[model samples]
Structures are given as C-alpha cells and as structure tokens.
Target: MQRKNSILRSSKRGGFAMIMAIILIVVLTTIMALTLSLTSQTTKQTSDLYLREQAVLLAKSAAELALLKVSGWNRATSGCLTSVNAVYPSTTNKIFDINVTMKYIGLGCGGSADYIPAIVTPESNGTVLMDVTVTSDPGVSTEPIRYFRRTLQKL
Candidate 1:
C-alpha cells in the first residue's frame, strides 16, 4: 500500500509539471507576437516621416527654382503670370513631381491686367506669388506624399 501511494503522488507531480510547461509556452508566444507587432508599426511610422520630410525639401527647392526662372524673364515681353509643371528624373518611374504656379500680385511698370485682372494687385513693386507642390510616391502606401510651399518674391 505504501509503494502504491508513492507512485500515485509521483504521477500527480508529473502532470502538474506538464501543465506548468504549457502555461509557460503560451506566455512566451504572446510576448513574441506583441514584440513583432510593435516593431512593424514603428518601421511604418519612420518610413512615413522620412517620406514627408523629403517631399517638403523637394518643394522648397522647386520654389527657389521657380523664383530664378521668374527673375530671368523679361517682364516687358512675357506675361505677368506663368505656370510651370515639371516631373523630376524625367523617367518612366516618375517617383517625384513638382508643379509651380507664379501669379503676379503687384502693379508696377511692367505689370499689366493681361496676367491676372480679376485678382487684387499690390500698389508697390512687382511681386510674384509662387505656389510649389511636390509629390512623392511611396510604394508601400496607397496615398502619395505631398508638400506645398508658397513664396512671394519681388522681381
């Protein structure tokens, strides 16, 4: 009877150990899954931030380029307002593109109603309002990254 009782106690202890092991496995699996999910979310957020910054920089540069173009133009010969649309790389990929619209907002020696007659014109020197939009394609996301910059330059 003593020997039988000892065997029974041993069997019960073995069963308890198996249950503990199963619980431990479940806890570890849950932790691992949570870690993976957090990592994925962090990666996506970082990528989005980077793309946004890039678009902003591109827009700024494009605006500067537009300003140069306007300054070089002969005000007497060209129209007061001009719209220029361009795509970067000029390749099939078209990863980034910019649209620059310059509108005359001042009435000076060269400013005329032929450019923007309906809009209010400033009474001072010739001023051009440039609107630059930069667009970038993020392959992973459904929506593209876009940045807009407006600059008023005097010519």
Candidate 2:
C-alpha cells in the first residue's frame, strides 16, 4: 500500500511540475513580447527626433543662403529681384530632401501683404521671406516626415 501511495504522489507532483513549467513559459513570453514592443517604439521615436533636428538645421542653412542671394541682387536692374527657389544638393537622397523658396517683399517687390503679417509692414529697404521644407522618408514607415521653417529677413 505504501508503495502504491508513493506512486500516486509522484504522478501528482509530475503533473504539477508540468503545469508550472507551462505557466513560467507563458509569463516569460509575455515579458519578452512587451520588451520588444517598447524597444521598437523607442527606436522609432529616436529616429523621428533625429530627422526633425536635421530638417531644422537644413532650414536654417537654406534661409541663410536666401539672404545671401538677396543681398547680392543688383538694385540697378529694372525688373523685380529674382527669388531663390531650388532644391539642395541637386541629387536626390533616399532618406531626405530639402526645398527652399524665397520671395521678395516691400518696395520694388510686390506681394508683400501676402507674406508679411497685417500688423507688420515690410521694411523700407526690403524684406525677403524664406520658406524651407524638409521631407524625410523612413523606409520602414508608411508615413513620411515633413518639416517646414519660415524666416523673414530685412534686406
């Protein structure tokens, strides 16, 4: 009888161990899945932030270039000053592209009211409004990232 009882107890213990093992596996799997999800989200956020910063920097550079172009304009010319509107690098990048558009305002230039706020008038010398647009494509993502920067400068 004792030997039979021992056999029954061993079987019960074996069954319990199996159940515990399954539970442990399930818990571990859940934890691992959660960890992977969090990591992916963090990586995406970091990538987006980096792209945004790059766009901002590119915008600033484009604005400076616009200013230089306007400064070099020959006032003696009869026609309106030529605005700068072009893409950077000329060659396309798979990741990002930068576009710069500059419009002249005030004095010799028209369409000042469209760009300049009603509260503020264009300077006597002149004003140049520069709009820089940066677009980035993250290959893995379905949506593309776009950043726009507008700068107003008195020439």
Candidate 3:
C-alpha cells in the first residue's frame, strides 16, 4: 500500500511540473513579440526625422539663391531690372524641388495698385520681396516633414 501511495505522489508532481513549463514558454513568447514591435517603431521614427532635416536644408538653399539674384540686379549700374528666376537641386528619398521668382516694381508714382509689379521692387523703393515655392517630387506620397512660407522684404 505504501509503494502505491508513493507512485501516486510522483505522478501528481510530474503533472504540476508540466503545467509550469507551458506557462513559462507562453510568457517568453509574449516578451519577444513586444520587443520586436518596439524596435520597428524606433526605426521608423528615425527615418522620418532624417527626411525632415534634409527638406529644411533644401528649402534654405533655394531661398539663398533667390536673394543672390536680387542683390546681383541692384549692383548692376544700368539696365532696367526685370523679373528674376531661379531653380534648386533635386532632393533624394522623396524630397522636393525649390523654385523662386521675383518681379521688379515699376512706376514709382503709379497710384493704381494694379500697376504695381507682382514682386517686391528694390528700385521703386529700397525693399525687395521674393516668392519661394518648394514643391515635393511628383507622385511623392510622404507628408512634408516641415513646411515654411514667408515674405521677406529687405533694403
């Protein structure tokens, strides 16, 4: 009778051990899944930040080029200043092209606002204003990481 009781006890202990092993496996699997998900999220955020930085740099370069054109015109002693045009380099990883245009204001005393040039005029007044457009590459679905638009008038 004692031997039979010992055998029953051994079987109960084995069943308990099997249950614990199953539970441990489940817990480990869950932890691994969470870790992978976190890693993926971190990678995606890094890519977005890098792309945004590039876009800002591209835009600034375009603005500088436009300003150069304006200054160049003023330095020229003679010749009726007209419109200015400029283009910027292409961006990679779905960035955009920068375009700038400036029109010279004519007729200092033209009372009609319609007669005023579309762009800021340094000749009529000392202030020159420019319009800048940074357009994303065609068919690029990525949302612009950043967008900046301003009218700058300088003497």
Top model by lDDT, which number? 1
lDDT (0 to 1) per candidate: 0.73, 0.68, 0.56
Better of 1 and 2 by TM-score: 1
The sequence of per-residue lDDT tens digits that candidate 2 reaches over residues 42-129 is 9889877877777777778867886786687665674444455554345464566666666655544444323432324434347767
Question: Candidate 2: minimum summed lDDT over ten consecutive residues — where?
Answer: 110-119
Angstrom error at residue 86, model 2:
4.9
Q: How well is each residue in 1-155 modelled by candidate 3, as lDDT tens digits?
A: 45455666676898899999999999999999999999988877777677666667766666676666666754445442333333334334535666555443442322332235344644556444455666655444344444455455453
> How does model 1 score by TM-score?
0.76
Worst 10 residues of 1 by lDDT: 109-118
Root-mean-square deviation of each candidate, in angstroms? 3.9, 4.1, 5.7
Which candidate leads in TM-score? Answer: 1
lDDT of 1: 0.73
- In candidate 3 the C-alpha lDDT for residue 67 amounts to 63
Candidate 2 lDDT: 0.68
Q: Model 2: runs farther than 4 Å from truth?
A: 1-8, 75-94, 110-123, 137-142
Which regions of candidate 1 fall more than 4 Å away from where they truly are? 1-9, 107-123, 138-142
- Candidate 1 lDDT over residue span 1-155, tens digit each: 45465766676898899999999999999999999999989888888888788778878888878878777777676655476777766757776778998766554424333234333544534677788888875663556788888887766
Error of 3 at 56 (Å): 1.6
